[model samples]
Target: MTETHATLPPGAPAFPPGRYGRRREPRRRRPLLTTLLVVALVAVMTLVSVRLYRQYGDPNYDAQVITYTGITDSQVLVDFRVNVPEGGSAVCLLRARDRDGAEVAREEVTVTARPDQRQVTTQHRLATTARPFIGEVVRCRPPA
Candidate 1:
């Protein structure tokens, strides 16, 4: 028996060529300025969060003015609300300001927390050197 072999045409290629080959994708590089900006933003945000927590997040004490009425030219009655921890005592600063924004009277009061309550409402009288147009609580904090 004789073996037969395939032959190519005279003008045809000896072997067929493929239309595609292995290719590598382009590498992406992050911008240095953008990376630095992102890092700075994160750092600033972290610092701001910590500062805010330290300043206003803690549950030390709080005070709010409920009402005020002028009793006399130099006297006023103020009703305010105070919040503190259970069985805690707080010191609050009350101020009476005149129409010119000057503090005509200032006083500090100690408030005690009840065993079953976190908020307390009380009234106090303030004696001012001059007539006051407004009375408010300046601040309240746990007694040292």
Candidate 2:
């Protein structure tokens, strides 16, 4: 009896022999399947990133805020410059923030480049609900 149960420590409860099913071996690690899954996930992420970039990313239309002046309780004047393809037009997003960094106003301004010009300077009077602390040109993109 001691030889049959030699692996158990003294005072440890022992189950009757063959009372339960045999224990299973540990499952083997499938490195190839894991590698393939990782590769597929990366491919999917790459595809999504490329699609998003193509849809929204642009290098042709760039904008900069030259100055923001005439701030008041009601409105602000924002002067900005946009670079577009020669003779092309773009729409730029502008934003105004309060001292606490809350958005006070936002608007889209459209600019067109002349046949021989790539940069266009323009200004917009953005109406606001409260006093604007600063104005900014967020981005520019070709008109939809």
Report every candidate's CA lDDT: 0.83, 0.88
Top candidate (TM-score): 2
Cα lDDT, model 1, residue 138: 86
Model 2's lDDT to the true fold?
0.88
Model 1 TM-score relative to the real fold: 0.61
> Residue 83 CA error for candidate 1 (Å)?
1.4
lDDT of 1 at 58: 53
- lDDT by residue for model 1 (1-144), tens: 221235655664443334344334987877997899999999999999999885665565878899999656798899999888877788889999998999999999998878988888889999999988999998887777
Q: Which pairs clash inside model 2?
A: none
Our tally of clashes for model 1 stands at 0
Q: What is the lDDT of residue 46 in candidate 2?
A: 100
What stretches of model 2 exceed 4 Å from their correct place?
1-39, 51-56
Worst 10 residues of 2 by lDDT: 1-10
